[model samples]
Target chain A: MRCPETDNQELLVAYGAGRLGSRETAKLEAHLAECEACRVACAAQATVWKALDGWEAEPLASDFDARLLARIASEEQPGWRRRWREWLRAVAARPAVPAFAALFMVVAGFWLLPRGAPPEPRADAALVREIEIIEATLDDLEMVKELSGGDRGEGARSL
Target chain B: MKTGVQQTVVGVAALEHDAQLMLRVREGDQASFGLLLEKYRAPVVHFLYRMVQNQAVAEELAQEVFLRVYRSRTSYEPAARFTTWLFRIATHLALNWLRDGKHERLQERLDEEGEGQTVRRDVPDRRPSAEQILLKRVRRDEIRAAIAALPAKQRAAVLMHKYQEMDYAQIAGALGCSESAVKSLLFRAYETLRARLRRLA
Candidate 1:
C-alpha cells in the first residue's frame, strides 16, 4: 500500500517525538490503523528510538572544571600576545606559502651574487698570450748578443 | 505595547531563573559561574561527546563551550532560553570541529572507552545477568556507531532529539535552522539508522 502523507515514516517520527499537534496525531493514528505498511514503518521508527535509548555518554573527568578554568586563565592573557600567537599558528599551518618562500630565497641568493668579483682583469687569456710572446722575443735577442761577443773576443786573441 | 510588556515580564522571570545566574557571572561572581558550570557541564559534555564521538575531545569541547560562554557573558542577552544559547555555542563549535577533522585518533579513544562500558542503572533493565549485560553493551556500541556514522547535522539533530529530549523548536534554535529543516535532518538520520540497525532495533 502507498504511504499517505499522514502515515508516512517522516510524520511518524514527529508523532513519536511528540512534535505533531493533537489533530495531526489523530490523523496519523487513524491512518496507521488502516494501513499495515505504515504501521510496520512506524513500529520500525519506534525501534530506532528504542535502540538509541541504549547508548549513554560517559561521565566527564573529575578535574574538568579545574582544567577549564585553567584554560580560561591561559587564554585571558594580553590580547596582543594571544593574537600574535594565533597569527603565528595560522602562518605555520599553511605549507605552500613557506615552501614557496624558501624556494624564492634560494633562487634569489644565486641570482643576486656579484658575478665572482668581476673576473680579475689581468687574468684575461689574450693578455697572457701576449706576455708569453714578449718573453720569447727577449730571450732571442739575448742569445744573439752572447754569440756576437764570443766571435769578437776570438778575433782579438788571434791578432 | 501589550506584547512589549509581556516580553518584559517574561524577561524578568527568566532573569529570576538561569539568566540571573549568568548575570551574576557577568558581574564576576565566581560562585554563580560555578553553579552554572555544575548544572550544565554534564549535559554539554554529553552532547559534545555524542557529537564528536570521542570522550577526551568532548570534554575539551565542553570546556571550550563554557569558556566561550564565560568570555561572552558581558554580551549575554536573555532574549532566548539560556539552554538555547548554550547549545547554539555548542553546535557551532562541534560543527566546526567536525569540519576540520582535526583528530582521527580520538575516534580510537572513543572505541576503547565505550566498548563494554556499563549501561547506566537508570536504563530500565528487567534482566540483570552477565550475558544480558554483555549483550546490552554490544548492542549499545552498535547503536552508537550507527548514530555516529550519520552526517554531522543529522547526528546533532538526533543527539538533541533523543538524548537531550529537546523539542523541534529548541533543536532548530540550537542548529540555527528552521523547524522543518530540523525535522528533515532527524527524518533522514532515523531512516539511515533504521536501515543499518534494524536487527538491533
Candidate 2:
C-alpha cells in the first residue's frame, strides 16, 4: 500500500477510528509494520481518541424537558399583549418600518383632517369672546336697574 | 454481507421514521413532538455542553435548539435526515453563542463550579481514594482544554465525529460543507488533539 501519510490520510483516519473494512484494516496494518511515520501518527491519534473518552458530560438537569415545554407553550399561546409586544419588536428591528410608520402617520393626519372647513377659534380668542359677553350682560343689568327708577344708591349697590 | 445490507436497511428505516415523526409534528401532532424531544434531548444537551464547556449554557442552548425545531415545524420538510436538521440548528446556535463571546464571560464561573458540577461516570462503585478522584478530574480537565483550544469549526467537527459518532456525510450535511472539507477539518482537529492529549493516553 502507498504511504497513507502522503497518499490517502483519510484511510489512516478511518483505521484509527475503527471505521475501515476488515480488508482495508488488514492492508493498513501491513503497511504500518513497514512505515515508522504512519505508526507514530496513528499512535498519537489513538491516544487522543482514548483520552477524549475520559471527559464524560454531566447528566442533564431534571427540569430540562419541563422548561423546554413551558417555553413552547408560552410561545404557542402568545397572548394579545405579548403578540403586540413581539409585533412592535419585530417592527422596531427594521429601520424602514419605523420611518414608514412615521410617514404614514403624517400623511394620514393630513388626509383625515376636515377639508374646506374653517379652522376652530384659538383658545385665547375664545376666552376673550367669553369675557366680552359677561361684561355686556352686566351693563345691560345695570341699565335695567336704572330704568326701573330705584334709589340711586340702592341701584348702584344692586348693579 | 447479508448483515451489512440489513444494517443499511435498518439505518435508512430509522431515518425515515424520524422524518415521519417530524411530519406528524408538522400536522399538529403534539405527542409526536414530545416523542422527538424525548429522543434527542440528552444528545443535544451533551453536544452543546461539549461545544461550550459550560453545562448551564449548554442546556439553555439546547432548549433554544428544540424551541427552534418546534417553531420551524410549520415549514418542515424532510430534505435530509432528521438528525442532520436537528444538529444544524444546534451547531448554528452554539456557533453564534461562541462568536458573541458569551463563553468568555462564563468561563470564570464554569471554573469555579467545575469541581462540584462535573460527574465521574467511571468511578467504581466502592468509594475511590481522594488521589484517584483528583487524578481523574485533572485528566478530564486536560482533555476538555485540549478540545476547547481547537478552532470552532474543527472543535464542532471533532465533537460530532467522536461523541455523536456521525459519519462524514452526515457531519458535512449538518455543517453545510462538502465531505472533503469535513475530512480536512477532522484531520487537523485530531492532529491538534493528539499533540495535546497524547501524554494523557
Q: Name the candidate that leads on TM-score.
A: 2
Per-residue lDDT of candidate 1, residues B1-201 (tens digit): 569889977767656468888988888888898999999999999999888877988898888899999999898777777888899999999999998876456666666987999646665556688798789878988987797789999999889888788888899999999999998898889889878888875
- Regions of model 1 farther than 4 Å from truth: A5-10, A18-27, A73-159, B1-10, B14-16, B108-130
Best by DockQ: 2
Model 2 / residue A108 / CA error / Å: 53
Q: How accurate is candidate 2 locally (lDDT)?
A: 0.87
Interface RMSD of each: 1.5, 1.0
Top lDDT hit: 2
The DockQ figures for the candidates are 0.45, 0.53
Q: What digit string (tens of lDDT, one per residue) describes model 2 on residues B1-201? A: 569889866755666888889988999999999999999999999999999998999999999999999999999978898999999999999999999999998887667877678555675569788898799989998998898999999999999998888999999999999999999999888878877887875
Question: Could you give candidate 2's per-residue lDDT for residues A1-159 as a string of tens digits?
Answer: 435463466876787788899998998888889898888878877888778777899899999989888778767774986687668778899999989999999999999987887977779988999999999999999999886766767779988
DockQ of 1: 0.45
Q: Candidate 1 lDDT, tens digit per residue, A1-159?
A: 657663465677877666789998898888878888887787778788778776787977999988888767668879998788768768978999789889999999999975665655776788989999999999999999999999999999999
